[model samples]
Target chain A: MTLLAKNITLSYHQYEIINNLDLEINPNEITAIIGPNGCGKSTLLRGLTGLLMPAEGEVTLDGKPLQQWSKKTLAKQIAILPQNPSAPEGLTVKQLVEHGRFAHQGLFSKPTLEDAEVVDWAMQQTSVIDYQARLFNTLSGGERQRAWIALALAQKAKILFLDEPTTFLDIGHQLEVMELLKELNQLHNIGIVMVLHDINQAGNYANRLIAMKQGSIVADGKALEIITSELMKTLFNANTKIINYQHNGHQKSYCIPVGI
Target chain B: MKTRTILRGPKTNKRFYISVFALAITLVLSLFFSQIIGAAKVNITDFYDFFMAPNESAAQKIIGNLRMPRAIIGMFVGAHFAIAGLLLQAVLRNPLADPTIFGVSSGASLAVIASIFLISAIMPTTTFLTSADIPIFYVPFIAFFGALLATFLVFWLSWEDGNVNPKRMALGGVILGSIMTSAVMAIIVGFGQAKAELAIIWMAGSLYGRSYNNLIPLLPWSFICVIATLAIIKPLSVLRFDDDIAQSMGLNVKLWRMVAILISVGFAASAVSVVGPVGFVGLIIPHLAKLLIGGQMFKLIIVSALLGALLIVLGDLIGRSILVPLEVPIGAITSLIGVPIFLIILQKSGWKLK
Candidate 1:
């Protein structure tokens, strides 16, 4: 029902990056983690997804220890879309998406009719049905991101984790991907957790905001409560003027930088 | 049957079957022609008569003892080299990765030559021996050990931190293979006339008069390696993706990679121990198979083995009959064909060798 991390610590070699961190991921909520560079945002996401093992404490899913669960069973429950995943040359979008069926089949078995239908459904959900015949490398950034998301959807996992889902995209493409995540979260009740660099986009799109300074979470709540000028000054060392603007019948908070 | 049809695309299965049939026919033709047109002529009737009633006639002796064994050995060696190449290329994700390029075959050659040199060096000191009386047996066993050692050395050199970089692996293999081959050459140079000539012929991969005795001990290991490679294909396909993705999909990438490397090394070592390092079969045949067959891992391997068997059998048959008395070594003939096809492949596929 919920993925929870308790008193977890992460390290690379001798340097501990995430120290004594604890958090709970609520079901079906889009949680966006925002932090400056070297803040261990991605590392925390990796730990929650069971991609990286914590040095201390434990990560538990549905009241069971993450380590005790079999890898295949864990994969069926959680799917991770790594940043800029590359495929072999000449792989079409459909084929790349079809690879997500691997954990389900457990072998290079032939695709069943139900599997094919699910693959098609995944593509339809991501709206990349037109690009199914195109090679993955041939698409533009936005199209490729959708194709990758489609691949994640094909896994049919309840929780979807993405690291920097909009790092290299332009403003238009970034919003396209962001809106797709929100759509998936709303329509299918899939839990979406992502590490985003832009604080404003996270404020606009995410249901809950988790701001990290260095390795520990500095603030965790609704976007308006956590993204205040005081929190920005204390955590990010930035002097900003906080402005509340009405957009599309909703009051939104915006941070306008004044000086360093 | 359901799984196969589902796995194959609409056209790939038909092409696969047709290609396999073509390869089988080519194999039979090479066997027939090799047997019929040797120095002394033998016919299909002679084979039939020999099968029906055992005899000691010249044609029967040539077909049963020499030509038949030669053809069968060609098939075995070809399949070994090609499958080894296919496995290595898939694991390393490099077009140039192969047993010969990785120094496994040259290491075997070096070990075989060193053992001979060591024995011959000992002979002159003892009063009962001379350089002319060099023992020929036990070279294959020594070569097999050397090939295994060389394969691991290549793997060990390429490993950095926790990952194996494909480019570094290929480079390490090439450098090690060259050094071993040079050492083999230096050993050949140190010998006197008769021994040196014999060693040179063996090194060039000529099977002038080999028979069933040489193949008996090596075949089982080769068979086992081929089966092991097939068993690991599913994991291998998963591994062809980037490492993180494979791991996220619940695959133990390192474990599968180790299994694959062991399988490839097993294939290369056993083949080189018997048939002196035949050139280009491992490197070129896999690429050819990939070109003829598309990117299905299972079908690509099968086709590579079949085509490799066909190529070597045909090469050996041509070597036997192309020149009247002066027989071209099968290795030399394969190189000639391999180099041109390799050039065409590079031009057509237009893949960066990197």
Candidate 2:
């Protein structure tokens, strides 16, 4: 399965952000979109996931026009977790996750056994099963984020989109979330597309990296091929050094600034 | 095992049913209690005989003409306001959201008072006659329209980029409600003592001397709208999430919010038309229901209506009995009782908006 966007022009009140961009998200891969604050990484994510309609061009998921597909059908095929989502007070982790199964159930019917089983599986996958009883507000930031991930997992969608999933997380929690996304892609073959701020972390974890500068895609390829010093200088407008290393017989690249 | 401790499907269902049954009992008991105990003594035998035999004795007259209609109106109005409040709070995701906050009540107040002043001004001979001479049927119509007017102003003012902010709506509502309230006061002060007393009683959110005429017209709207609230329960639950997340979950957030708002307006306006903008029942009952049912969507939805009806009936009873000659307004009593309970819940929940 593939999600494709072509000639997409996204704007905020006449201010064009993503200008005539084209991209594709292939199935069963962890693709990370990274860019600076105003470079439109988040807007591009929103465009690709059908959160915002483009002023020009179109987006397609699995050979169907994104707008033509019913929202429920699209929901079953794709799940999205927005940045810094807030849940109602007194809502438990279990309750939050159960919301993901909304598209699966009949309009007025309660959750069936299958839905319950899916919620349980999601919790276990995210390792939030132990905290199911706790109110979402009482959980730590990382735990709360995982609970939201569990919610997305419960949707059982083939593709998942997250906007800055680890922005507020601590370093350890960030690594945990990145590893969790990688595991989801590898084990379940879910297409995971995320907007991440940390370029080094994106290069380390994601199989494919798409870097943007001022709403235009600067580089899109495997991490090692795309993380050259020239590309870093071109994209970030900063002089940076790139070093290659070997880990587990695989080559990896990291960006390092030249100055002290 | 996992479901038992957290979801606890069967156990939670059992608890919900038990509370429902308990609430149903209290509802009936309160209705019965409101009937038998009033300021005027009604012989129980006469009440029983009136049911069996058509008689015009003092006890039968008081029971049939006075207490029964008041109690029936209380049950339905209480239910209406509570459910309306619960829906508004849920849709807005703001605990402070309520019908009174939305200008519906005070708008109804202004409308009722304005209608009276207009009629009195038009016919100066009727100015000194109590509300009894002002024609009771018009207040319901005038008040309902007033509520609708208030809601329109609030929504129109709060609309921004095709989205309505609850904070803006709440702030707008409070301001509009206050303006209408102050207008009501101006009208009250413009009139003489007897008319002023009538206007004051109406503004206090009292259901004093309400008849079946008022209750009958509100029934079709309130009862049907209350049922319709259940139909939107699925979308309403989804609405608790932010817009982007709700949309991704296959919900039309804007459409559902509109539908929910319209339904809530219908419920609130109809009830307020009859009951002079009763307050706190809507604000307090949903929280009370949540405390009882633990926010499981179905149980929370159903139990809120039940508890709302129960609270209103009991509040009316307490209002009628407490001061004998001076009947406390049900609205005042609810706020008095509700404020303490609200504070306790706030203290317990730590008053977090999140």
**Which has the greatest lDDT?**
2
Looking at model 2, residue B276 earns an lDDT score of: 75
The candidate scoring highest on DockQ is 2
The TM-score each candidate achieves on chain A is 0.97, 0.96
Tens-place lDDT per residue, model 2, B107-183, is: 77777778777777766643322344566655566777887788889988898766897888998999999988888
Which segments of candidate 2 are over 4 A away from where they belong? Answer: A229-241, A256-260, B1-7, B43-55, B112-144, B188-194, B352-354
* Pairs that collide, model 1: none
Q: lDDT per prediction?
A: 0.80, 0.83
Instruction: Give model 1's TM-score versus the native structure.
Output: 0.84
Pairs with backbone N, CA or C atoms under 3 Å apart (clashes), candidate 2: none
Question: TM-score: which candidate is best?
Answer: 2
Candidate 1's clash total is 0
Candidate 2 docking class: medium
Q: Per-residue lDDT tens digits of candidate 1, residues B94-176?
A: 77777888887887888777776787676643211122334334545677778878877877898874678778888888999
